[model samples]
Target chain A: MTKKQTCIFLIIVAAVIAALITGIVLTDGLYERDATIQETMQDVVLHERDKISLFGLAVNPGLISAFIVTGVILVFAAIVRIFVIPKFKLIPGKFQMLLEQAVGAFGGLARSNSPHKNGFLGAYIFAAGAYIFIGTLFELVGVPAVTAAGECVILPAPLSDINGAITLGCLSYLVILSGGIAANRLRGAGRTLKEFSLPVSMSFRMFGALLSGALVTELVYSYLALSFVLPVIVGVLFTVLHAIIQAYVLTMLTSLFYGEVSEPYVKKPKKQREKKVSSKTEVVQ
Target chain B: MPLQLAAVPLNIDWQQILLHLLNFVILFAGLWLLLYKPVRSFMQKRREHYEKMDADAEKKQAEAEKARAEYEEKLAGAEQEIASQRRAAELQAEEYGARQRREAEELAKSILAEARADAARIRAQAEKDARADVAAIVTDAVEKLALKESASTAYDQFLAAVDAQSAASKKPAKGARTEKDHD
Candidate 1:
């Protein structure tokens, strides 16, 4: 669809989802009971049930429902594209236009990297993978679903634990692995697979470090249990750090991929010399 | 205290945690398939469209610049032509003025020569007329003197002759009368 249409669609979908999540959080007894129980426990949970609201929509909130809903929507869109539209030989009209524009951009990026070879597949894979990774992280954090409930979402229970730290590290490693694979596939001459791995590794390392720091800080401060100000401060600090790390990781990976794809076309002097010598010998003969 | 602490058993829901984790993974996959891909694609398309427009605009700008230079060159050529024409006109005017001046000088010279010739003819005629008049006057004066001298001489001679004749006749008459008186 046209950009405006797509945006509108997203907004409408988001609104509907938000409304649904809000209804679920407010009307459903599960989230409220869970919050009360957790409060009674006074355990090592990183966030208080009372302080968290879904953008102020929920009296008490759970983000799991929102994540599930958004996930369903995504899967639904993919299914529609694959089955209904593709089978009928029907174009998505404005939606196709939007898709084409995206394709062209990725195509351009690919072309820039590998003028000789097609980089479209690589770009597509990378873009798709990145989205999946970010979405997964967001789901894990329960942000989108939390936003739906109008609550200030925090990382869920196990993620704040020591075990959670290890889980996140494993997830980071998976992301790095995927990134490395994509880089390798896209890589051209003059670039080693190792070169691509560097950025992927760095991204994971940085993510790990940030997560570690945040977890340690939360454990030490017990800020989530304190007054509202302390929690806000800690949240802001963690978010900023997280955002910086994420941005760095994304940028480095993109650069590495671009470099890998474009490297082959750059001719070495020895090749030039060989060609020149062959041509001269031909002329002389 | 030990008995009271031991009496509270821990209740952990591993199933719920696993379900949530599974849900999170599924949600992430779904989002990647749908929203993120499309949004990114849209942005990329927008970027490409703008880049194409920019390149086209740059090409048009270069063409406009070339056209302007060509127009300026033509204008310079026209200016040069006008300048050359002006010089030619000036030269023509100079030549025309010189021809007019030369014609005027030649006319003046011819006029002066005619005037000089006319003056000389008049002077010559006047001199000729004056010479004839002087000759006539001299002749008239000479004739008048000659006539006066001749008249005086003729008068003197006639008087002398008459005196002689009277003298002779008187002597005769006296002699004859005396003879007659004597007779």
Candidate 2:
């Protein structure tokens, strides 16, 4: 930044810190609650009373967050499809380059793994990767919704919930199974069936990784002293890191298994060739 | 038999799982239609267009090379034809020069033989005329001797006749000069 901009930034920071101190002093007992650490922990672990009803059914906060992320993604996709994509030039601009890179990365992944049958596999991985990465980042938005008990709660990352993780993991396995079936028919299905532990492993891995970030962030917020600036670093670091690592891990594993199961079956050589080989040896002798 | 299980930590709701699955499916379909398919098709089309342009350029270059080779081949053939034509003309010119020289030599030999024949005939005619003149002169001298009884006067008349015969022989020399001009 320039000298003037740096001075302005420093002044804004000081003013915001002053305002926070004043607010803390003024609102000291305004929002006080007589809840124990165990109760807070129970609320974090099981949000039974914090569920929001969607279409006459109670859904977790993470589900609402998932819907928000999905809606945003869909709207963004629509905009790109209708307006941005048509303007893409042969010589790409910055936005076009980014879009092409994202699409090409997934395409290259699918092609490298399953060269023979990667059309559907490429599309699946692209969708799955987008969902995981963006869904993880959705938690940072801190959009609050009122629960069934009229208590406002921040919607967490979607994959932090077991339902979302299990759904994605099983879906990935289904894609792999479909790839196998499409390529090698019954034999392909059998190959997928041979690795029955894939869905469970993939689900729990995603759930654990994402939940650890949520839990750590919760733990920081639970303590009043550490809630000031530490949650920012911890929350951002954990969410972003888990997003990248989990997205990569799941997509890579799915493509690998899909490729293995979809490999073309090679037939054995005929008996006539072996006989011809022996006859040639006899002739040589 | 009913078995009562202890507290399970997981809130595994089948409905929520199903809803999440449904949400992902919708997202996948929407993205496929909106983003992935169209973008990939555009790239594939661009690649094909450039490939076609490259092929056309290569084809034109090959045609140009073929045309250049043909032109060079024709030029070489034309050069060989020109050389052969020049050689034929030179050989024809030499033959014409040799034939002209041979004809000139034969004509000169015939002209020399004709001139020799003309000289020989003129000499023979001169010899005959001189013999006749001498005979007449001798007869006249004999008559004078008989008439005047003087030998000296007859001898003077004979000398004059010999001088006339010598002057007449010079006419054949003029005829030989005409023959030299004809040669």
Candidate 3:
């Protein structure tokens, strides 16, 4: 930049910093006088109820965030299908290549995992992976909203909510059970029934992973000493890490279990039971 | 773990769970329709179109190659036929030329033989005529001489000269008499 441009940029940055400091000081004074906030900013961290009143019904913050993320995803998919997908050439453009690679990878993973080869699993996994990744990073956009208590709060990631985690976990388990049943019939139900607590374990794992990031960010923001640069650093790091790790973890677990349950059990006669064991070793190899 | 779960507000909200499930299902359906189906269809069509075009081009190339090979084979056959016909024609022409040459040689030989015979006959006739003219001139000279001198004395002189000349031409007269006898 030229000297004049550099000077102007520094001036604008200084003005923005001054405005932020003034705003924070004013808000601090107002909160000190208000008895409602005198509980020493107890809600700055994890709160019991972050309820949002939508259409005269009490909805959780996680639910609204999910709705928004889903809407964004839908609009994005529509735009790509209309404006981008039609323009796909025999030789792919960057956006077209990115979409193909993403779908191909997820589909390839499912196909490679399932011994019985469920063709639909790939698409389902792609959908699930996309939702998890996007929903985890949804709150990083800092979408501000007003709660029923007239307080300003940014909506957190949808999966950070226990309810969202439970929904995803249950859905994955159902998908696995369906794959097993499709491949093995009644035997598939028996196999799936044996892993009855899978949904609970998966839900807790996801919920805990996402909530840890949120809680850390909140803890950073809650302390006056750490609210400035520290919160920004902690929040971005935690959010990005959780987005990638949680997305991979959920997708991996779902695909693995789906693959396991989808394989048909081979029938061996009594005389060939030991022979089946030898064959099993060869199959494993 | 139980204490941690209790610490967070993880109450089972059926309404929220139901809504979230509905949202995920919609997302899945939307992605499948918008992204997977269209991309797969486009790829399938493109692959089939290219494959069909390649097959057509290959088929045309094979046809053209077959036609060219047939044409080459036919051309080679025609060339071989033409070569054989030319050889036969050349051999016939050579045979005709040799026959004509032989006929010409035989005809030339007969004509030369006839010409030689005619020249010899004409030369003999001229020689005979010259000899007769000389004899007649000689008799006339003798008669004129008798008129100028005594007849008996001139006749005696001519007889004596004839006798002397006869003696000198005896070998030629003998060969002529033999040839006349043979004729």
Q: Which candidate should be chosen as best, given lDDT against the real structure?
A: 2
lDDT (tens digit, per residue) of candidate 3 on B6-39: 4346465766788889989998999899887787
Q: Judged by lDDT relative to the true structure, which candidate is superior, 2 or 3?
A: 2
Tell me the docking grade of candidate 1: incorrect
Which consecutive 10 residues in model 3 chain B have the weakest lDDT in total?
B1-10
lDDT of 1 at A208: 53
Indicate the docking level reached by candidate 2.
acceptable
DockQ each candidate and list the results.
Answer: 0.05, 0.48, 0.47
Evaluate model 1 with DockQ and give the value: 0.05
lDDT of each: 0.49, 0.86, 0.79
Model 2: runs farther than 4 Å from truth? A1-20, A24-45, A223-232, A267-285, B1-9, B57-79, B92-183
Residue-level lDDT of model 2, residues A1-285, one tens digit each, is 899999999999999999998888788677565566666555555555578888877888878888888899999999999999999898889998898888899999999989999999989999999999999988888899988777888989889888899999999999999999999999999999999999999999998888878888877876767877788788887788888988889999999999999999988778878999999999999
True contacts kept of 2: 0.68
Point out where model 3 deviates above 4 Å: A1-47, A227-233, A269-271, A274-285, B1-9, B49-183
CAPRI-style grade of the A/B interface in model 3: acceptable
DockQ of 2: 0.48
Q: lDDT tens string, model 1, A199-284? A: 44543454355445445544534322352456455555655455445533543445345445444444578988999999999999
TM-score of chain A of each: 0.38, 0.85, 0.83
| Model 3, position A272: C-alpha lDDT score | 87
